[model samples]
Target: MYALNDIVEMKKQHPCGANEWKIIRMGADIKIECQNCGHVVMLSRREFEKKMKKVLKKADSDK
Candidate 1:
């Protein structure tokens, strides 16, 4: 399961040639920023789930 600030890879690489994205927002919709180009986008949770390949890293948080 992914949450805010997690870094993830998508099924397809971005046109900018980046496959990694950082989660910047989470809710009914999810927002991510491209790791390579600083591009940002928001997608529905369903879309995010459909496109997400795997989470590369989870956000660090104090428990």
Candidate 2:
């Protein structure tokens, strides 16, 4: 299961040319932020599940 502050890769590319996002919040709904463009979007867990390709990496202290 995903948690807050996890970095994941999505199946689709962002308009800003980034495919990475940081999960900011998680519950029935989730909030994710684009790494390159600084955009934020909210999605349901089901939606996120469908869109996510794979998790690149989780957020670490160095990130």
Clashes of each: 0, 0
For TM-score, the strongest prediction is 1
The pairs that clash in candidate 2 are: none
lDDT of 1 at 57: 88
What would the per-residue lDDT of candidate 1 be over residues 1-63, giving only the tens digit for each residue? 988889999999999998999999999999999999999999999999999999998887524
lDDT score, candidate 2: 0.88
- The TM-score obtained by model 1 is 0.91
- Of candidate 1, the 10-residue stretch with the lowest lDDT total is 54-63
lDDT of 2 by residue, 1-63 (tens): 566788899999998899999999888998999989889999999999999888777667446
By lDDT, the best candidate is: 1
* Candidate 1 wrongly placed segments (more than 4 Å): 61-63
